[model samples]
Target: MSAAPESPAERQAIDRLFNPRSIALVGATERSIWSIAANDNLRRFDFKGSIHYVNPKGGTIFGAPAATSCAAVGAPIDAALLMVPEAKMIDVFADLEAAGVGGAVILSAGFAELGENGAERQRAVAAAAKGAGIRILGPNCLGFANFVAGAPIWTTPLRRPMADARVAIVSQSGAIASQLEQFAYQQRVGVTHMISTGNEADITIADAIDYLARQPEPRAIALFLESVRDPARFAAAVQAATAAGKPVVLLKVGTSEATARAAQAHTGSLVGDDRIFDALCRKLGLSRVHSLEELIVTADLFARLGPVECEGLALTAMSGGMCEIMTDQADAEGIAIPTLADGTLKRLREALPPFATPANPLDITGAAMLQPDLIPTALAALASDASVGALGFVFDAPLKDDARGFARSFIRHIGEGFKAAGKPCVMMSHTFSAVNGEAREMTDSAGVIYSGGGVRHGVSALGHLAAHHAWRRRAAAAADNVPAAAGTTNAARPNGERDVLDYLATAGVPVIPARLARSADEAVAIALALEANVVLKIASPDIAHKTEVGGVALNLRGEAAVRNAFDTMLARVREAAPAARIDGIVVAPMRQGGVELFVGTMNDPQWGPAIAVGLGGIWVEALKDTSLRLLPIGEQDALDMLAELRGTKLLDGFRGAPAADRQALARAIVAIGQAALALGPDLVSLEINPLLVDGARVEALDGLTEWKESE
Candidate 1:
């Protein structure tokens, strides 16, 4: 029996359809093409639940008695399938609402796809369903299936048995979802559940994921999203799935600007900023696939093979040419295949002929195909060796009758041997001839992940699988004990340089101390009091980039120099932003430090707040060498962000220069994240450019923050 549903309303809806006492098929007809196909599909599957057909002009459908309307069913309906015309969808929904329908699968297209008039009708349907507390699947969709219960409520008929499967397929495109289902059926791979979220008007992909996460059968979820409506909610769902030990493989299509615009016009969904979405996915541990085929193949492997334990890989092929090709591809893709040890090589040579070379990608010669047991023996030897964690098998077909059988036997024996020895193996099969049933059975039964197409595809899948494993390991190890604040703080205000510096100091970000002076004598006195070479700047909240306005003068060595520079800077500021209000000349002691860095934090309305750190000074924008991390980051995360910078060489003692204090830099970034979290939406932007780093300290030379009024 299927497990009890956990999501209250969602469970009620699923249970009502899968194990319902009765179901009413609205818009059912003897002449409708969908009805005829659906009726035949139901009979073929031998569904045990009570089925009632409802059609206004119905006589009978597939030998089942018909009802003039949903109310004519004369019993409480659990779920109703509305395969009606677009114009009549709302009215039929109203009738179902009046009849107290529990849930509905709307297979109508006119609601959202037919322009304004249809959109109004779609709204009406949604309003009626919400008012009646009825859960809806879609107004323009292919519907869903609950495999365990033999519940195939989809518009298209499916007759395959629901094998115990671990992967759940969810897609925004109906065609992609159907393709995945067909692919799985052809591979003899079972599907736990499949859902096509068409025109996500009411229920969304995130909601489906949140609900499906409660199911125990799906060990992984394969998602194909054309657009994302709620980025934060999607991030949260992905995080929840990760916490539950279930990986999510996602294929996000239509990322280009033109494609995004097309998606918006097609579904009325905000395509969202691509960069922010990509960053969110990385932060939340969602493995991204680039194509539909890759998504299906990777998901299937992850579901069947489970997680790979180690990064070490060993490639074994019968031909030297294939080995060379595999090696070059693996190197280009960053797949590390360690060289075999001397002892391992010696043992392999003893097992095979003296001419056999036992390198990383062991080429035991094409003659091994004649030996039949040679391939499995070599695999067994490698499996026993501690040097190899995983193995790759490349098969080249020969023009012999037993060639197919030999390949089949080799796959089965090696697959069982690897499992027994606690190792994983993937196979690459290249042949112009069509793959027969015997070859497929051997590949599947042996638990070998087969790459039936191209060598690059097989390598790419292994590389992705390895990368995912590494990502999970890093994420797990980086879990820190930083407590989140109860509420965000507010720091939005138009303040001069002094006030901005004070706020940064209060947030635990180190900044240079300075005093504001109204006149040249005051500036001279402040510079003299510090007893060091000073930097002078106009302290105006209106002039954020003071250098552009000629308001900044560095290396004011004495009182005379300070006085002269202050007067000249004041006149330049007045000339630059003539209408702007001038604050005063600010003087601060200057200290030589290594490396200029820029660190900033901003609150994105869609994906929450994020912090970025990069090479500072004029090249910050031009080079754009930066790394971003989600807000509320811990010290470790801050350090990782800094380490990821391409300009990290500047911090690592470049050209005989002393290395900058990365620890202090990390602390400053973490502080920035804390300030962002505390400031909430009231804070617009917080930037500290040209932050100086010395032996064990870092100082923010300049700081600025923009604010928004609170509701």
Candidate 2:
């Protein structure tokens, strides 16, 4: 279900899978584990749709009448869940498809994970599924669940389904999906859908996300993924979800070598570069979580309070110790806990005793325990503060019912007050197990989010929410102001150093003032005309690393010195790299006393044009500290990347050295991004090493450009 219509074939197939009117269990039985579990869970969950059992032996299953085959049943089946063996899977699918089944979820293993033979069988199954216009979920998958439809197709032990589902968990690993479900239920978080896109031979994770984006029941989406099969469709789905006002939280593994190899062996998925995936996530406004804890916690926050739109947070507590703990956690996570506005302080002073403090992490003291009204009054004042975008109330509670009730009363009253103001509020307990049914009910009724895990988890959730809010705004602004890269009408020819410099200069990246000279006398004349100490380097596309090839000379002060250096540089280049296609020598006036930096771009096949910035000079490789972001980024993004570097103090003039012009450097970075956008795919890669940065000036001292192809 896309905002735009899905292809007629695909749309009908997805509809049949998620909203099946009639389901036929292909390998229905009384004894097999998966079959028994499926039948028992369906009956327990009380699926409203028509259910049919098909067994070759013609035995009834779970009191449902059995049919010998799809034709014997003699009706159109919407979906079939097959628990058959690998050898019989293809034939079973063919029977269902010929019987006009719309979708199939095959729970058989031995496909892809078993190597080449299994891979070949999986391909044959996919071809048969497509030929019959059937959308298949897996040839080796654990099943899916649609809680809203009361269709728990998953074969697992059951808890009573949640009444009001809000978050959808879509994962590639069935075991992980089940683990997440159990964890969510244990934490009292409601889930709308649990989909495991195992193997994804036909229907992909992208398709599932796209379909879920149009579902009204899910307020947020949590994706547990290894890789994306279709990047374009995946990106579009993310955009659609954002536009539809649903947040997408993602947990992607495969960053390490062992994990990547494991992923390939397990699911036969290509673990693409994780760094590129990270950049893509940032570009798409996806909140990427690294662990299972983060995934559940982040999604719970989104489901409980909706999207967080504020940048600052206010923390209120009854105990000063709890407040201190929360403040420490917030600071450790880099979450902003701003001071209360003057008016907010005045209001708090009137409500609380003189011993109570009126600041962020405001400690209302034990006085609030006696005067219950003080809690709501303080919360209202803090929510009304101009600087506070969100609010959190943390209180200490024991595991006893009485303590839980007291905590509940405080939360219910605070939630009621903040509900009218319509800002997000979080009710957290000092201990994870202390938050009981009463506290959770307060959240459900009052629209306040409850984080049962202590101060650290609560603050971490708030930190992630606030960061996403800020990034979304920046992404939106960039989208409106910047144009996307256009289609290439013509290819670019391979460029030499002069061509690279000329192209960069036109794009506002300040290249050093230089001239190409074929002769030593010509190079000396160009250096003397500039009337400054000059550097000469052999200009050749083949000799990209000039210094490594002995093609560079520095600090020639006189005409004779420049002429001698030019001849020596040519001779050295010939001796070092005799086969290089030398394109003459470039002589430029020397720029001194500045920090060496690098700015680069690559038209990433998956993410598209991205810019990278780092400390340059010869140690660029040795000191691999750098930051990257997708192209068409603003000046602020460029500046933020610079500030993120570990060596930022070097740019700030460490130990009495002159501070480099960071603004100038940021502009140069932006210009590189702009050039990348303008050139599109034709500009394969561009690198400007030793981009010198002095006070209020930046220059590209040397560069290399790789083209798409010659016309």
Q: Best candidate, TM-score-wise? A: 2
What tens digits encode model 1's per-residue C-alpha lDDT throughout 528-629? 999999999888877777889998898878878998998899888899899877879888988775788887776555566667788877767677777776
Badly placed stretches (over 4 Å) of model 2 are 1-5, 256-272, 318-332, 342-357, 396-400, 403-405, 420-422, 434-439, 442-447, 494-496, 549-551, 575-579, 632-636, 647-667, 677-684, 707-711
Candidate 2 pairs with clashing backbones:
none
| RMSD (Å) of each candidate, 1 decimal | 5.2, 4.4
| Predicted structure 2, TM vs. truth | 0.90
Candidate 2 residue lDDT tens string, 166-243:
889999999899999887886777889889889988888888888888889888898999877677788888888877
Deviation in Å, model 1, residue 48 alpha carbon: 3.5
- lDDT over C-alpha atoms for residue 23 of model 1: 65
What is the alpha-carbon lDDT of model 2 when measured against the actual structure?
0.78
Cα lDDT listed for each candidate = 0.72, 0.78
